[model samples]
Target: MELRHLRYFVAVAEECHFGRAAARLHVTQSTLSTQVKALEREVGGPVFVRTSRRVELTEAGELLLVEARRTLAQADRALDVARQSVRGETGVVRIGFSGIAVLAGTLAADLHHFHRAHPRVELHVTELPPAAQVQGLRDGTLDIGYSPDNGLGDVGDLVVGRGVRTTLSIAVRHDHSLASAASVAPADLEGENLVVYAADEDDDSVLDRLGAEQRARVHRVTGTLGALVLASAGVGVAVVPAATERVGLPDIVYRPLRDMEADVEVVTLSRPDELGGPVRAFVRSWDRAGRLTQS
Candidate 1:
């Protein structure tokens, strides 16, 4: 039977009097009686037995009332959950990151804040290489990413969120000559053995910037920590975001790169037109964190 039929049955069952049930349901007594009869016919059984003095439920009526109440309650709960998801209060957001030193902690902090505010929402984080983050975002495996801007190009369908610039710094062994300098210029790295992030096919600018002479001295490392470890062991110096110092390697000293500029950008496959409340909240938190760090 339809929902209205179930509701009419419930009301009549609860009130026990056709006239009173109709009044409670804002319907006439005859209308209520006819609807209840229709419902009984649809169910293939009588729902109530009537006497001149009172009305009482049959066994079938009792069972239908119990089940009808449960069904209505479940339907209401499902609607509430769907609404929450639409409001961005409950659902899953898959976030990808690369280069732990630059965006990992900031992303973690924003996630903690978002979780506190919307505990029903699930945040899934993955650490991937810069190239992998881009691929994941494009392929719908990741909803958002945090990575250096160099990795993300003008992918027609993707949206890039507000980005913040963080200075590139030189990571050198504490005993290295350049480690003693207040700041090292690009020219200072002329003949120095340099450790760098492994190039992806999309990274032509980085490759081009380090021309033949610089490329000759370059040693590619698999990850941020590997570059730091190599620098610490005196295998070579590395150029990393200033944030890298936060990872805390005692044997490695970080010196600002006097002329280089690098930025860590937040990327998303989600459309600008479709950004939900949670995504907006996260972007705000990220912006605040960048301001705090800058100040």
Candidate 2:
């Protein structure tokens, strides 16, 4: 039977008086009677036994009334969930990030901001390299990506936002000669053994800029802490984002790169049209916090 039929049956069953039920339901007594009669036929039995003094529910009416209320309650909940989803109050957002984002505490901060605002929404966070993050987004496995600006300055398919721009610095042991210098330049890397974190493939560009002899001394590592740990032991100069100064490793001192522009940016990436409302809201939240500049 239609939900309206159940609703009408419920009203009449509760009031126990057809006339009063019709008044409560904003319908005339004759119309209410006709509707109830239609409901009785649909149910293949009498829902009410009417007498001159009052109306009493049949056994089937009592059972149907209980089930009808439960069904109505479930329908209400379904409507509420649908509305909440549309408003971005509930859903899932999958995010992929790199080591630098974690080292800078940017990924954690963004997660806290979004979770506080939408507690019911599920956030799945993953740590991945820049290439993996890009691939995941393209393959529909990830909704958002926090990547370094190695070569993702312009991706034709994905929407990119500049976020957490930082300068490059070289971490060195306290006893290293460049550690005491005012600043280290690209030229200053000449004889130093290089420990580069390939955060966004920028380490490749750094290596390409070096001479053949210097390239032979370059060591590549993927993790931020791994590079810094090596630098602390005097393995080599660790090239990292200047924000790494926050790390406060005693033996490792970060010296800014002279004449170098802002060398690293934690970029925010998303599929332009495929993003759900919650994911877009998450991005907008960061934009409002001034953490991202959308291009």
Candidate 3:
């Protein structure tokens, strides 16, 4: 009838004596007997046979004892798992990133630090365009994302956890005319083919700022690596975050664009009320890294 009833029944069945079972259970013999009687009544049968000298289990008592032990063990395991989840000791974190964001070290370092600190938590990282990252966050395919700060209009349900200022720059072949300059201006690209990641017309992307004539000369590349490969082959110039310089593409030089800057934001789509320990730790680590960079 109740968990305690099952417990008392099992203890009585194991000890086969009223007084010893009562002592083991820390209950009076009368109380234990009463509970066992309640269980037997609930099951519509006598669970024990009593004699003046001893007590022994009936057929139903043996079967019920086995099931009761299993049920209690399962309950204990369930409680342990729930506590672990609450403490952020185990779970999965799915992270999404835009192409240029991966070129930076933020995504890679964050994953490294998070795993080092919480090894039990599984980390899954996916490369996506900024728009696709936002969509993934909205649809629950992603838990967190590193994407350009374009207001996240379509993903209005997502929250911007933190942001870092990223500078846009041009990647050109070493022999290109502008590669020798310390910095370049947007107008310097007037006649050159520009390779960029594809985006929707309504998106507030850096490419949107280029003039109509510059847009006309632009070519859409499939991915970040492709853009760099194209630039290395002298197909066109590639625009990417200043951090991308660390990617170490040989024969390709990275130069800052004087008039353009990009901002990257970390986004979380879950309800604010559900903020958990792991997510908080991740954001704190990100902010600390950003501060170190500024210093």
Candidate 4:
């Protein structure tokens, strides 16, 4: 039967008086009596035993009352959940990120802000390469992403926004020859082996500015932290984003690269029109203009 029928049945059952139930429901006693009669026909039983002086429930009415109350409670909860979802109050937001996004603290800061504001929204974060993040966003597995992938081409209506603006730095051991230098240059790393993150883009990093000989000496590491660990062991001086200074090891000294003019940017990626309510709210939580500036 209709939920309204159950609701009317519950009101009559609770109040046990048609006049009182009508008053509680803000309906005329005649309308309340008509609706209750319709409910009895739908359920094929007499729900109430009417007496001149009193009203009491039939055995069938007692069972229907218990089930009716439970069903109404469940229906109310379902409506509340649907409302909350539509309002961006509860739902899942899947986010993907690249290594530099974490090191730059852009991902963490944005996550914290979103979580504090929408505590009921589930966050599913994965450390994906820029290519994977791009793929996920396009294929509908990810709602939002942070990566160093600048949409050079093939992005197809995906919105790319700046997530970080920082410079590259050299993380070297204390005893390394370039450690004492206040600032470094491509030329300064001429003889030393360099540690760089292996990324989806070809020339997106300091490797593009290095001379052929220094470029030849490059040791590409996949993990950002792996590059630092190797640098701590003197395998090679780590070439990392300037934000790495916050995570500097005791043996590692970071120096800014003076000649690399273009500031490195980690960009955020998302589909234009496919974002869900909670995902859209989570994306808006980021203060994009101020990302990674101090970090």
Candidate 5:
């Protein structure tokens, strides 16, 4: 009926001796007998048949013993899962990411580090534009985000951590005349249609910065990889973070943007007061990655 009753019944069924069962359970034989008798009455049947030489399980006792072991095992597993969850060893963490911030910044490295450190933590990573990241964080959908400072930095009531700055680079088709050049000046991009990240609702944009000194019209792509692919197909020149070259996609050349120096900062954003243990652990993992980089 109860857990203790099942436990007592299991011990006695295993030992097959009243005295030994009581000793194993750290209880008196009389007490064990009374509990077992109570259990038997509740079940409306005899759980054990006793003879002078030895004790044996009746048909009801045998069936109950098998089910009882399974129930106890399940109960123990449930307790363990609860304890682990409380300790932040296992849970889900929802992370939102902007194109360059996640793929071209340290966010990608930090993700690998976090997964290695907390293998049991489930990571729900979403690739979103800076505006979406802000919205997701503002609502309860996203616990944390790796985003550029342009849109997410000045958002309401969110905690933003200082992040590394990334220099801009020009991505162009491999066969383009200037692709082999050491670096590209903003003048070179003048009159050239440029593929750029989808602009956030905020006015401050990396594309705007890169094209500030030029007359290029911006054609937007939703993600970092998409921007590069469009550039590779000669759709337009793309100004991307230098870190994007780490992927080494073919048919595109990433060259430093010279003459005009524009830098975008990638930062971590989280709910001001709603960050949970799993989310904190994820942030801590990024901190550790930063330390290792500095070291």
Candidate 6:
């Protein structure tokens, strides 16, 4: 009838003697016998037959024994899993990010460290735009988000933390003019057509310090990688985070943007309060790995 009754029934069924079952259960013989009798009454059957020398199980008792053992084992396992969750040793952590967030620096290394250390924690990762990531966090669909911190306007309700600091770079076709330059100065891109993010906030980001729009045409795409892909096809030169250098796109060249005083602070966002166990553990692991440096 109850888990405790099942446990008592299991102990009694295993030992087959009132005294031994009571000792195994750390209870008095009378207590064990009374509990089992109560269980038998609840089940509408007798579970045991006792003589002066032996205790034998009824057919009902045999069936209840098998089921009771299984139920108790499952209950024990359930408790173990619950405890593990509370300890942050196991559970799913939904992490949202743009493709470029984990590409270059400390944020990338932090992910590796967290994964290696908490192998049992399921890292359910998704690629989302910064606006979508912000929405996901607010809507409770995502536990953590990595996005360009620039365009997340009025995200003050989210707990934004240092993720990675990245320098700006120009992604151009291999044969495009200035691709061979060691580093391209902002002034040199005066009249060039440029690829930027779909969001106006992103368009008006740190890249605007270059004053590209005063003389250049701007094309907008939904993602940083999309901008680079267009740049590779000579659609336009893309102002991208330095991580684009590692993407290995054919016919694409990355040149550092010189005289750009501002860096893109790719940051992590979460709910404004202390997070759940798994997410908190992951954030702590990131902090412990010393990945908070602004590069």
| Top-scoring candidate (lDDT) | 2
What do the candidate models score in CA lDDT, each in turn?
0.71, 0.81, 0.71, 0.78, 0.78, 0.79
Q: Which parts of model 3 have CA positions greater than 4 angstroms off?
A: 14-31, 41-44, 51-55, 154-156, 197-201, 208-213, 220-222, 259-271, 275-295
TM-score of each: 0.80, 0.82, 0.77, 0.83, 0.75, 0.89
> Higher-TM-score candidate among 2 and 5?
2
- Tens digits of per-residue lDDT, candidate 6, 1-295, equal 7898998888877888889989998999888888988998999989888889778899988998888888999999999998887777889889888767767555566667787878899988888888888888888999988888666688778776676678888899999998889999888887888886644434466445666655337776657778888998898888888876788888999999987686677787777554577887876775675543322
Worst 10 residues of 3 by lDDT: 265-274
Distance from true location, Cα of 291 in model 1, Å: 11
Per candidate, the number of residue pairs that clash is 0, 0, 0, 0, 0, 0
Local accuracy of candidate 1 as per-residue lDDT tens digits, 1-295: 7887888888888988998999999999998999999998998989899999778999998898899999888878999987887777888878777664244355666667888978987888877766777677666687766666554456556555545456567799999999899998777888888887652633544434434265767776546788899999998888766677787888889998766544334333333443555555554555565532211
Model 4 pairs whose backbones collide: none
Query: Over the stretch 17-69, how does candidate 4's per-residue lDDT look in tens digits?
Result: 88888899899989988998998998798999998765689999999999999
User: Model 3 has how many clashing residue pairs?
Assistant: 0
lDDT of 5: 0.78
Superior by TM-score: candidate 2 or candidate 4:
4
TM-score, prediction 2: 0.82
Most accurate candidate by TM-score: 6
How do the candidates rank by lDDT, highest first? 2, 6, 5, 4, 3, 1
Tens-digit per-residue lDDT, 1-295, candidate 2: 7777777888888899988899989998998898888988988989889999789988998898899899988888998997887788998999998878876677888889889999999999888877778888899999999887764435668877777778789899999999899898888988888987674544475454333256778777766788899999999999888877888888888898876554787888888765487887887887787765445
Write down the lDDT that model 6 would get.
Answer: 0.79
The candidate with the higher TM-score, 1 or 3, is 1
At residue 25, candidate 1 shows an lDDT of 93
In model 2, the clashing pairs are none
